[model samples]
Each structure stands twice: as structure tokens, then as C-alpha cells.
Target chain A: MNEKTVAVLKQAFKEFYFKNAEKIITPIRMKEREFGYMSFDKVMVRHLSFQTEGDLRAFLIKEMPHSVYYSCAYYYEPTFAMDEKGWKGADLIFDIDADDIPTRCKEEHDHWICKDCNFMDKGKRPDKCPKCEGMRIDEKNWVCPLCLKATKDEAIKLMDFLLKDFGITKENIEVYFSGGRGYHVTVERSALEELDQLARSEISDYVSGIGLNLESLGISKRASYEKMQRMLPLANDSGWRGRIAKFFSEMEFECYNSNDVKDKMIYIYRKMKHKNFENFVGEVIGKLSTKIDAMVTTDIHRIFRLPNTLHGSTGMLKRRCDDLLSFDPFIDAVALGEEPMQIFVDHSPKFTLMGKIFGPYKSERVKLPLMAAVYLIGKGLAEVD
Target chain B: MGIEFGLEDLAKYPFMKEAGDYVKKLSLRVEDLGQEDYRPAVERAKQRVMEAIQKNYISIEISEPIVELLSFPLALMLVKAMNVEYIIHRYSLAEAIRAESLLKEEKKSIISYIFKSTFNLEPISVKHELFDLKIKLIEYLKRATHFHEPEWKLINRVVDNGFVYLKTHELVRLIREEIRRTIYDRMKGVSLPSMPKNLKEAVHEISRVLPPRSDKFQRVTPDKFPPCIIYTLDLIKKGQNLSHYGRFLLTTYLLSIGKSVDDIIDIYPRSPDFNERMTRYQVEHIAGMRGGRRRYKVPSCRTLATHGLCFKDKILCAKIRSPFQFGKKPLFKKKSTGQIRE
Candidate 1:
């Protein structure tokens, strides 16, 4: 990207924040929490704090950092030594990203070049280069509708689990689309504020379905025969046993296709012949569990991308997902300034953005919108002409 | 070690099942609970159970550990005269809520029987307890729903699946207040068989249900203390020998008023038998460090009176309920010579 392109993106970001200044907020007790950001040169800045939203807005407008972040933790003295900064409590947050959500398109349009071997290949990068076994693999990922849709599905699943199972209400939960590929879900309830690392780890396990004992839900050989009987005897029971039982009772009598039942909830109950019940439970759990970054959920001290800020990498707003089902990151999250900028496309896959299709332009000069140009250049797929 | 029993254990005890089923049906009919019509029958059963416990014959049935389960309804039977409707509802609801929380924590524990059974048994009760509770709470919410839609919706969803979910800490506080006003008041003076080890467990079952009360004042103005607390401070200044309970009340009061635990311990040296280590330990324990990790709630007016340490003017004693409620409104119009009297 040229200096002019970066300057335009910066101006666009400044306008975005200025327009949404009232919506911006630092963590509670802002002066007591450490903030971090990434500069345009990609240099890291840490140990930052703003006394007010106005102060933070002024700094963001002045520096126009690529990304902004604040600590999830409330510290005793933020600028003190790490251990010396007494950690009070933190908001429990879960991060789900498209990068973490594996899609076939990643293998189709994404390309990785090994800097060490100068070897190139399409699709997901291997840990080591296939030709020379070198570890330095630089990757280029193109955003597509299919992958974004997959990411949204993951987000929906997570929201459902949090609300229905975890008993977290919508008021306490805030879902925001990360300017990049994923979504961040934050639980801001005071009930969860004092949760230590271990307690938070338990929540992580529940959501991710890690180490859940099947026997606990009466889906094991060790489950007393009486429990198994109760599972069948009563039609109204509600745990996993009831869920499985309800699934069986609700099914049409003669579907006759084992393939149809294989992937259904009935499969777990159908396989419960006492001996292999545990295996069935495990399989069902694997299919139903929501994927999340367990580390992000468990960490008492974390920094997340600030909401309402423009993501430098995508030229998209890190907007809150009020309407997740209808939220299109391509169209809805595009940053301000629609003026097309001239750039020579290095290489890019055909992608639909802003309700229009553009792409697959190899070494061709193209005039793209300011936000689109920034995104292409950010992905290393284009440069200023 | 304590006769490892769960709600499922009630199946082995025929008599407990019979009594528990009776109590569950009786409890569900809230309108019929107010009359003393069913009191005689429950009292008779409670007497029979107490006689069995005193004779030590009930403990012999290791195969049927029904003592804990039986004691719950027995205690309720004893306190039935003290507002039966309130006690029965509070006892049943508390037990169900506690079961849900415990089952959520220790999923593999035998408490699953509590989630499975339809009867409200002794230790952990039946599966339908959650369903019953949901019906009652939802009706209460419909009559007087104070929360936002998200909170209400979450409670509805959790209850729909036959589970009760307390969405926010504030909601939990609201429930606890209801419990305190109902059950805690009724059972305050009711006597039960104290000899059976299971009696303590049964009575204390819902003890951990309340979250720790926070008395952290942003800025405590000690001069604004209620006449009673001020009287106690004056006693401390004069090196008076306050009783053990009196010392406990004072130490906790001072600590909650922003005094350091060490500072609280130091104030106790004037006492006749103050050993540094003992004083420190007692102080820390009251501060919720050495024993259960729960801070002490401020002693209410009635509790202070029970200790016979309540020194208050007629206005202070009649109007104030708690120490925290004293300085909350800034209505005191006294200029102090640092001396306060009842």
C-alpha cells in the first residue's frame, strides 16, 4: 500500500470514530485498566489508558491506530509491574473466528508462499514447506460469502448455548463482529465478575463440551438400570435422557432409513444397547457442542478488539451484531469513504462485496472503492497504481 | 461417611416415600396450606419420626437412609403453626433451587436422583420439583414481573426445560429476600429434634443458598452510626467485657465499616482473655478467611436483642433494622462529643 492509501484509510477511520464517539466506552474504571493498540507500521503500543471517552476518541483520531484494545481485567494499578497490578476481576469473553472455523474455501482460494524455500501453493498452509520443509509460510486469505456464513453459524450456535444452557440473559451478553473473520461474545453480568480462572475454566468446558462425563447424564453402562428405566418410563423428564427420549418419541414410526437416523439425535438413543452407550454419547456431544476459544474464556486477563473501531486489515467496522442473522460483514461493516481508489491488482479471487462482484484481476489496473482498495491492499492482493 | 444418600435413596425407604409424597401434594396446594386442617396429621407423623430417632432405631436401617429426608418435612411440621403457607412454600422452593445449583456443580453426584424423582423426598427431591417450582415462579413473575425481557425470557426458557435458572445476581437477591421473609421468619423459634446428626444437615440445607451480603460503603462516616452501634463503640472505649457474641458483632461491624482485620483484632486486646493469636484467628474468621469463605451479614435488630446486647434509644431500636440501614440516609442530626447513649 502507498502512503496516500494509508492516509485515506486513516482519515476514513477518524471520521468513523468521530461520528460514533458517543458509542465508544473504555472498561469500567478506565484509568485503572491497561490498553494496547497496533500502529500503522504494525508496531505494538502498550500501557495506555484514557480518562474519558472524549480522551480516548481524541487519541484514536490523532494516532488512527490500525486496531484498538482494552484489558478485560480491572487492575489495582494498571501501569505497575504485571504481578504488582492487582487483578480484581474480568468480564468473561468468548472469541469465535472464521480463521478458527475451517472451511473448504480456505483450501480453494487461500494461498501460502514459503519464504524460506520460495515455494508456493494454493490452499491452507502446511506447518512446514512440502518442498524444503521450511517453517516460514506467508498466507493470503480471501473472504467469501460461504466462509462468512459458516462463521455466523458458529456465532449463532454459541449464542444459543449461552442463553438456553448457561442461563446467561441477552442483556448481559454483547455480541460484536470482529473487523476480521470472527465474532466476540462478552458476558458482562456481575454474577460472573468474581469468577476465578478455575470457575471460568468450568464454563469453558461446558460450552466446548470438554471432559463431560457421559455417565453423569445416564448414558453409560455404569448408569444404574433404574436410571435407564426412568429415562423410558417418564415421558416428561428433561435432561439428556429426556432429550434423547423425546427425540425417539417424536420421530415418525416408519422412516426405515438408517442413514437418515445416523446423523440425527435418535442415533444416540438407537445405539444405547448398554455396551456402546458411552461411545454414542461422545459422538452426539461432538456433533452438538459449540466451538469457542477456550483460552479466551478462561483467561482472567485478556484484551479484545474494541467495538465500533475500523479494522485496518479489512477496512470494516468492528460493529456490534444487533441483527446477527441479517448482518453482512461485507456490506454492513464497510468503513466510510466510498470513493474508488486506483490500484494494480497483484492477485485476488473473485469475491462479492457491497452487493457487487469484483475480482480475479491479476496484475490489472482497477478502480475500487476506498474501503475495498484498503481491504485488498491489507490482504496483500493489490498495491497503489 | 454420612450414610452416602441421595434422592434415589428414598426409594429404599417406604415410609419416607409415603410421607414425602403426602407433603409434596400438600405443598403444591398453596391455598389449602393456610388452614390448620392438615396440621394434626403432619404433627402426628413428626412425633412418630422423633420417637423413632430418639430410640436410635431409625439409624439402624443403613439400607434405607431416610432420616435426612424425613427430618425436612418433620421440621416443617414443627413450624407449621408459624405461617404454614409461607413455610411450606419457602422450604419446598429453597430445596428445589438448591438441588438445581448442586446438580449443576456436581453433575455425576447421586443428586441426579433429585432431578429424576417426581416426589419431594428428603435430601434431594424429585424431578418434577423443578417443574413445580417453575410454575409457581412464573405465576409470581406474571403477577409481578420486575425484570427486563431478556432476564424474563431466560428464566422462562430454563424453566421450560424443567430447570430453574436465576439469570442475574439481582434476581437471586430478590428470591433470597422472599425466602428470608417467609421461611426464615417462621422457623426462627420452632424447635426440632437436635440429637439426630441428620437434623443439622436437613435444617442447614438451604444455608448456602444466599450469596454473601456486601456492606462495602464507599465512605463510612462512623459519626453517623445508629445509637446502638455507637453505644457498643463507647463500651469498647471503656474496656468493658462484652460477651463472645457481642465481640463477634462488634468486630464484624468495625471490619465492614472499612477497618482492617488487624485493626479489629487490636481493638480486642482490652478484653480479659485476649491472646494475640486467638484474637487474630477469630478476627480473620469473622473476616471470612479461616473457615467458610463467606463474609458475615450485619446482625439485625432482633438478632442483637437475642444476644441481650442491643442498647438503643426507642427511636433507634424501633426504626432501625440493620447497621447498614443506619447511615444510609443521613437523617441523623447529632453533633458528637464522641459519646452516644441509648
Candidate 2:
């Protein structure tokens, strides 16, 4: 960014923090927390402390940081050795990233660049840059409707699993749009407050469906030569068993045939028991299991972006999700501001925000709402006109 | 026919030799577990432990796990007698921590016993670090009843963080290992139940009847009933004969939920083995109309499972202690409005 644009952004940040300083609140056991922020040159200002929320708010307004974060961990003293830092406990958290969701949008716009050779190509990222065959490559990912929607579905699925399988009550859980490209689910039950990293990891594994014992799950092979016909039991069952049964019985793989699919699968399963039973069942589990960022859940020492705070990357609020089904990130997560500003647009896909269409423009100077302008500027795709 | 065995008799099983010898040497009363009135036996165990404590001579030869096993009934009895928040003992810090770890791993059993026995004892004196570890472990065990696959790395984190107190935690592991080996050795020559060919059906039966204990639950809702009550209601609908304990569980559970004695007795008539005079008398006895004014709390979920009666299907089965928790509060009243999560 030019010095003039950087000055404008800093001024905007200062004004916003000054007006909204009252909204920020520190987490529990505040005395043992380490605060951090991003500076203009991407320098991380860490190991910072504040006496009160008021002090923290004043610092943010004065510094006009690009973003802010507080440690998820609580300690006896903020700056102490890892072992000496009395580990109190951490809230159980799960992250679902849109970039991780497998979808067709990747082929359309996702690209990779050879960091060594500067060779760029659009489409699915290759392990090594094709032109330079360089090992050091950087993946450039962008969020689209398909990928974001898929991630939302994954998040909802994970939420259901947490409630039903992990036995977490719905009331103890809070879901938030990550303000960039996904959602974060935090569990705040007092009972779970002191769960060590290990206990939380088991929860993460269950949510991600990792290291599942197939034989114990009743996916073992049986010798059967007879013409076996069965409707996989779906009714009066619960958990994974019921889910698997319903998925197969519903014939979702065969264009929703729903007619005799269970019988056909049963026949095929019995016939192919000696050869493909394990693979088939494994495939089903992979399809059904929730894909979550395991590190987020297990890292008791992690620092999560504070909820309700603005995310510098997308210029969106890390908004709480009230209803999973109706959460539209583009509209619901947009930071509330109505003032319009003119900006030089670079490249952007056709995107919808606040029930209005914007972009599909390439390098055009255009006037847009403050939120849109901030979003474009924040993404580094546009500059102040 | 009920099987009969004394504490000494357990020595013949090989695994119980050390445990049996200690009990015999201590002159602990080895009551006939087969008997219906085992209350006096447990009371005697409590008395013996108290006597030993008074004498200042608890046998150190007995392993920590064995000591715990012997002390369980005693601790339980004492907790009820004292009605304390927890049962604490003045013992070696190492021993206490070791005992706690083994007890901690058995989450469901420990939690149910702790609640039923009302034990809330802590160690008399210890280093602050080890004390904190024990207290944290105890608190963790009390709260954790859910069955989750153990991750050793996480267990190591506790060990690493509590490095100064690692010796105590290691002793806990040693006790666990020894107990496990004893069980393995005892079962070596014993004929095990035949493995089910239809493993899926078998697993389904086990999970349905006894879902792994978890603390998670929606607040008790109007439509959601405890599994024991649901199972008993199902049995009554099918006109099946109920066991003595089952009958007691049902009567106490129903009465506690405000069901009238007449209403409870009416449901029993549908049972194939129902005797109007006998059923009414037993129901009245449990309702505290005949049996001394003392009313009984419903048996713990583990006790229900041992009798082959627990029918856990709903997630609520994981957390609740008694059917009474489902009194009037609708489970997740806030969830109905869709504002709680946000």
C-alpha cells in the first residue's frame, strides 16, 4: 500500500476503535493473559499486558492495529516458562475452514505459484509448480459460494455431532462465523473448563472421525454365497449406525433412487464381502465424518480472534451464529457501516453482500459502500482512488 | 441358587490372593454377598477400617489398589454415616495419588459410588503441588463420566505438567497395571462367553441397553423419561415378571415423580406373575408406608445395568442420576426460542 492509503486505513481503524472501544471485553482470569496485535509492517506486537479493559481499549484506539488477539490460555503469571505458567484450563474449541472443504470451485479459480520461479497457474494446486517443478509453492485460495456453503454444512454437521455424540448440551455451545472463511464452535461448559489438552483431543478426533475402529463399528466381513437381501436398519437406531444406514437406504449416491437401494447395497455388500467390504464401509465413513481443523481443538495454548471483533482480513465482524441453516456469511457478517467510498477495484468474482450484488469488475474505479470498500481494501485487491 | 464366597475364598482365584490375605489378616468381616441384607456386612467393614485407623496401623504390604478395594465399602459406609461432602484420609501422599488414579479411570463407577455414598474426603496433609494434583484429579473424575477413547499424549501432558508430582501419578499407573494383570491371569483358564457371530446386533444390544456414561444432556424435558422408568413401563406393557430390585426401582422412581400408590399398583396387575395382595404390600413397603419411615433413593444407573435392566437410548441417559431430575423443567427451554447458542 502507498503511504497515503496506509494513512487512510490507519485513520479509519483509529476512529472505529475509538467509537467501539466499549464493546470489547477481556476473557475470564484476565490478569494472566497476553495480548497481541498486528502493526502496519506486519510486525506482531506480542507479550503485551493491560491492567483493565479500559486500558486495553485505549491502547487499541491509540495504536490503530490491523487486528487484535488474546491468548486462549490462562496462566499464573502471563510471562513465565511453559511449565511454570500455571495452566488453568481452556474452552474446548473447533474450527471448520472453507479452504479445506473439497469442492468444484477449486478448479475454477484456485491457483498455485512457484515461490522459487514466480510461475503462476489457475486451477487445482499442484504439489510442485508445473513450469519450474519447484517444491516451494504457495497456494492462493479464495472463498466462493460453493466452498463457503459446503463449509457451513460441515460446521452444522459438526455441531450436531458435538451435541448428540459428545453429549455437549446445546446451551453450552456458541457458534461464530470466523469473519474470514469459516466458523468456530466454542464449548464453555464449566465441567469442560478444566479438561486437559488430551481430553479435548479425543473430542476433536471424534468430531473429525479419525482412527475409527471399523471392526468394532460392525463393518466386518461375513462369508455369504446366498442371494442376500436386506434393508439396512435405519429406524430405532442412533448415532453413526443410523446415519450410515439412512445414507445408503436413501440411495443418495444413485441420484436419489430411494427404491430398493438398500437391498441392492446389501446384496453387493454380501457378494463383495471378501474383496471390498472394508473399502466400501471406509468410504462411507469418510463421506459422513465431519472434517475439522484438529489443531484448533487440541491446542490449549491457542489464541483465537475475539468474537464480535472486526477481522482485518475480510473487514467483517466475527458474528455469532444464531441459526445455522439461515447463516449467510456475506450478509450477516458484514461489519455494519453505510458510508460509501470510491476505490480502484482489482479483480473480484461476482459476489453478493447485504442483499445487493457487487463486483465482477476488473481494475475499474468504482464507488461502493463502506463495508465493500473496506473489504476490497482489506483483501489488498483495491486501493484508495 | 445364589453363589456363596468369603473374602478368604477369593484367594483360590489367584488374582485375589494378596487382597484376600490382607482382608483375612485384618480380621475384616467377609459377609456373604449372596445375602439380600448385606447392609450389616458393609457396616462391619466400615467399623474395621475405623478400628485400624484408630490403631495407627494400616498394612502397607497391601497394594494401593487392594487397599482401595477393601476400603471402598468402608468409605461408602462412612460417607453415608458422616454425610460429608467428601471422604478424606490421612495417608501417604504417594498412596493416595496412586489410589486416586486407578479410581479416576473408572469414571462411571467412581462417580456413581461417590454420589450414592456421598463421600467427599480429602487427604489430611501433603505438599501443595501434589495436593493440587490429587484435588484436580478428584475434581476431574467427579465431573467426567463420559466414555471417550484415551489419548496417551494428553495423559502425558498431565504427567509433564505435574513433573514434580510424577512419582505419585506413576504409582497410580503401577496399581492399574497390576490390577489389569491380575484380571488377565484369573481369566486365563476360565471359559468366556461365546463371541456373537452377528457382532452388529450384539453391539447394538449393548449400546442400547447401556450407552457409555456421559455427562452431556439436554435439560430434562417433559417427553424425555429416564431409561429405567421407560424399561419398566415397557415390561409392564408386555406383562413381564419384574425382579425384586426392578420392582423397588420402579416403585420408588414412580412415587418420587408424584405417582400415587394406587396408580403404581394398578400398572403391576398387567404383569403375568402379578399377585394383587403381594404387589400392593411390596409397593406400600417401598413407599415407606410399612417399612420404617425411611424412604430409599432409587439405585444408581450402574446397579440397574448389572441387573440387565437399563435401557439407555436417549443422550440424557449419560448424565442423570435419578428419574426425579426430570420433574418439571423442559429440556433446553432456551433452545426452543433459538437464541441460546448465539
Candidate 3:
């Protein structure tokens, strides 16, 4: 970003932090957590510790950083180097992002530009530039209602797993809108807090259904329909067996007998070719499993975006969602004002914000709401007029 | 504390916490073992260590309860004085095996007491259709993470309301792991006092009988490769269409053991649809030279099993976590220079 855009974003963020410093809630065990932030100049300053919520608020009011983060882990010495710090435990966190989930709306709103050849196109970015064969491809992803809805569904699926399979109580789970195209579910003060990285990886795999085997559920490839019906997992079975059996029941197959849900599913499976059966199994797994960022859950020392803090890319607050179904990120997470400001839009996709639609602009100067102007300016798609 | 075991029970499983309390109550100093009165206990201690190293199982000969109780601590002291890593591991395993056998006949309350007082684990007795005892999920995970079998995975187990249901034998196995770790930890970091003449002679004899440490990691040749790698290599050489995971396994295994990118590329020419550019790019990527700049490691033995690629040689692959760990000892007798040949 240019100096002007940075200055504009910094000023807006400073004013917001100065007025709403109390809205940023203090995390549990503030003294034992590591705090970090990215300055306006993009230099990350980390390994910082705060003793109280007052200290954290004072630091935010003074520094006015572009983004703020806190560690997921608790350490004995929060300000020490990575290896020197005694790691006590970490909260089990999962990040369900719209970027990882596939939605058809991305083809309409997302685009990629090759830095080397100046070629721009829509849809997902390829690994290498098709025109220039260069590796420097810059992608511009814009969130839409469809993509955001996909992420919310994934978050719901994840919570279902946590509640049913892992048996974590609802009160221990906190869901947050990431201020930019994602949801982060954190499990705190639970039995999962002290799980090491390997065990956490297993939990991630279980929720995501990474290594699920049909044979483990007694669904063998060579078994006949009659044999499979006899050996099929019942709907009352626990864990994945129960889950797969319930999925089979909900699949709505034409049944000759009403009580034979297993028989109907087996009849369909017996008719499917070997390749089709694999695809059918894949579809079942896709519906049952969550699409969580495995790396985030597996990383013990990762820093996450602080709640109620502005995300630099979108100028929105990472707001906590009490009811995930009714929470709308574009409205609830908007932290900037509605004062009008003029900005020269280089290029941007049409987007919705706070119940208003903005233009798909091209090199035009327009007076937009301060929140939209800041968002466009932060994304490097607009400049101060 | 209300539940008490007899002296015979204490002697049979001397690593129990109550046995430790009994030994502390005796107040026997190290010098007391050198006297003629404690000669039988001292000799029994030496025999304990020797049996652990030679037979991998200590046969219980508890003719005298006091002597048996005293010998357990003495044996621990002797092991700690030697302070060799291999001996500590073997002795701990042997002791844990003995405890497992004795625990098989104990009552539920007794097993639960040992679980709490010894390992600090809380296993609640429950009446379930398939299981008798249930431990908290986190407690189960703390020990089960070291296990590589698919059945041991938390996803495959019977868990409800954060408790994992386990059978009596399974619970005994977890206790065995805890006992092994406790014994191993107790046998470390000891500064021995001046030994008596007879004790010194026992130490010298034990040292003479100690097995030589094997240097299995020294030679990295194709003949020493694990069965999975060898199977993948055979498939590649036979011009069979290998899966993506098979190719990844072969390439990473060869690259990790210091094989050059070009040499690995040469092994892939037998594939019917060989493309030099694509192969080079993939090899370079896995080797950490291109894209992400992070070298890929060979997946663990459990991962291989999940992927259905593990052609397990039960004896050769025993206790090995990764493909690189296989053939740590030579698979066959051979006489050649320890060098990688193309």
C-alpha cells in the first residue's frame, strides 16, 4: 500500500481504538498470554506480555496497530523466546475459512493478476501463471453471501462434532467471525486444553474425517448386500459408525420395508460400480466431515486475531457470535463510521456492506461511506482522492 | 490407605507405592546391604538385574517376603548406579511385565487404587455392555498417543461424555505403560555412594554380561530398506502404475537417506508415462529446493498402515515408527564397504 492509504487506515484505526478500547475483552489469564500486533508499516512486533486489561488497552490506544493478535497457548514466561518459554497448555482452536471451502460464487467474484505479464482473469488462481508462466500471481478474493454461508455451515458442522463426538459442553465453545471471510471456534478450559500437538492432530483428523476407513465401520468392499445388512452399523452405535448409519437413514433411498434403512442403503451400494461406490462414499464423508484448517488446530504456538479488533484487510471487528445462525459478518463486524469520504477506485468487485451495495468500479473517483472507503483503501483497490 | 495388601502381594509387585512406603519404613542404609545379615537380599538384587537383561523377564522366587521386598530397592539402586540407558529401558520393561501379570488377578478397587496412587490416573468402574472400566479421554490420550495401532486411536474407541471405555486387559496394558515410565524415571540421575567389595564384584559381573549396543543407523543401503519401501521400489521397477502415495513414499525415502535428485529421477524411468520435466519439478519440490522450501519427511509407520501401503514384516517392522527406522539392523549377513551404491 502507498503512504497515503496507510495514513488513512492508521487514522481510522486510531480513532476507533481510542473510543472503543473497552470493547476489546481481556482473554483468560492475561498475564500468561503473549500479545502481538502488526504496525502500519507492516513490521510485526511480538513477544509482548500484558499484566492487565488496562495495560492492553493502553498499548492499543498508544500504538494504534493495523492488526492485533494473541497467542492460543499459555506460557510461564510469555515474553521469552519460543524455546525458552515454558509451554503450559493451549486451547483447542479451529479455523473454518471461506478460502478453504469451495463455493461456486468464487468464480464470479474472485480474480487473479499475474504480476509479470499484467494478465488478469477471474476464478481461482492457478499454481503458475498460464500466460507468462511466472510464479508471481497475486489473487484478489472478495467474499459474497454464498461463500460466507458455506463457511457458516462448516462452522455449524464443526460445533456439532465437538458437542456430539468430543462431548465438549456448549458453554466451553466460543465462535467468532474472523472479520475477514472465516469463523474461528475455540474450546477453552476443557479437557482438550492440555492435548499435545499429536493428539490435537488426531482430533483435527477425526473432525475432518481425514483417514476414515469403511472397513473400520465393518463396510467391506467385497461383502454382499445380505452380509452387509447383517454387519451394518446400527443408528444407535457411537462415533463414526452411528454417524455413517444416520447418514444412510437420511439419504432417502426407496425402501421396500420401512424398518430396513440399512437394507435399502445396502441395495443401492450393491448396485453401484466399484468406482461409483467410492464416489458415493466420498460424498457421504464430505457431508459428514468439517472443512477445518488442520494447520491452525495442530499448531501449538500460533497467534490468533484478537476479538473486537480491526482486521487490517477489511476494517472490521472480529466479533463474537452468540447465535451463529443469525450472525451477519458484513453488518455485525463493521467497526468504522458512515461519514462520507472520497476515494479513487483503481478496480474492485461489487460488494455488499451494512445493507448497501457498492460499485464494480474502474479508475473512477467516488464519494463512499467512510467504512467502505477504508475497506477499499485497505485492500489496495482504492486511493485517497 | 485403608486398602492394604499382604507382604506376599507387596513382594510380588514391589514397584507399587505401598512397597516404596514399606522400604522407606525399614530405614535400611546402603551400607547395611554390605553386612552379612543382608547378603541374601543383596545377592537377590544382583540376580534381578541379570534376569532382566538376559531373559527379558524376571522369574519370581519369593521364598522370603522381607528379602524379596528389600531386593527390589537394592536392584533399583544397582540399576541407577550403572545408569546405562539400555539397561534402564530393559529393566523397566521387565518390571512392568511382572506388575501386569500380578495385576490381572486383582479386584476392580485394587486396580483403580493402583491407577490413582501410582500413575495419578482416574479410572472409574462402570458397568457397560463391552467394557468394565472407563478413563477420562485426556488421560487415555496421554498414553495412547504413543501407541501406533489404528485400534488405539481415540476415533475408533468407545468414548462417551469425555470418558473412554476400556476392557480389563486394555486397562492393564495402559497401566503397564505407566509403570514402565515410572520405573524408568526413578532409575535416572542417581549419584551412587562408595560400593562395598561384594557389591563392586556384582557390578563388574553385570558389566561383563551387558549386551553390546548396536549401531543400526550407520549403514543406509537399499538392502536395508523397510519392506514398504522395497515393495514400492519393486512396483516402480516392474512398470506398474504406482499411486501418488507410493511415488511420494519412494521419493522421500530415497531423498532422506542422501540419494541425489537425479538418481531418484533415474529410478522412475520404468513408468510408462515418464516425463522428465514434471518428475524433476516434483522431486525438487519434495527435496525442498522449489516452492515452500521445506523438506518433506517420510510419514510414520501408522500412516503407512492407514494408507494400505505397509507390507509389514512383523519381526522386522516391530516397534518401528517410520520407514526410515526399519532395517536398523542389517536384514541379511553381508560383507561390503558401508557406502551408497547407485
lDDT, each prediction: 0.60, 0.59, 0.84
Residues A139-193, candidate 1: write the lDDT tens digits.
8877688887887887887776666555567888888888888888888754566
RMSD of each: 19.8, 27.2, 11.7
Task: State the RMSD for candidate 2.
Answer: 27.2
- In TM-score terms, candidate 1 sits at 0.53
Q: Second chain only: TM-score per model? A: 0.32, 0.31, 0.63
Residues B140-229, candidate 1: write the lDDT tens digits: 232222222222322222332213423223233334324333434435544443323333333343333322222443356556777667
Best by lDDT: 3
Task: Give the better candidate number (2 or 3) by lDDT.
Answer: 3
lDDT of 3 by residue, A181-261 (tens): 899999998878898877887788788876666665556778877677766677776677678778777676654456666
| Residue B275 Cα positional deviation in candidate 3, in Å, after optimal superposition | 44
Off by over 4 Å in 3: A214-233, A252-283, B29-44, B60-67, B189-191, B194-198, B215-342
**Best-fitting candidate, measured by DockQ?**
3
Which residue pairs does candidate 2 place in steric collision?
Answer: B85-B120, B86-B119, B86-B120, B86-B121, B87-B120, B87-B121, B88-B121, B88-B122, B221-B331
The candidate scoring highest on TM-score is: 3
Tell me the tens digit of each residue's lDDT in model 3 across B1-342: 487778887898788779889988988777777899989988898999999998888876688998998888888878877877568778888989878887887888888887888888878989865578999888888777656456777766766667788888888887787898788777764457887877888888888898744323235766888999989989887998788888899889988787877667767877987765568768888998754688999988899899899998988888678898776655555688989999
TM-score of each: 0.53, 0.54, 0.78
- How good is the docking of model 2, as DockQ? 0.02
lDDT of 2 by residue, A157-262 (tens): 9876766544567888888888888998887744666776545665565556555543333333562322233214342234454566666675444333446644
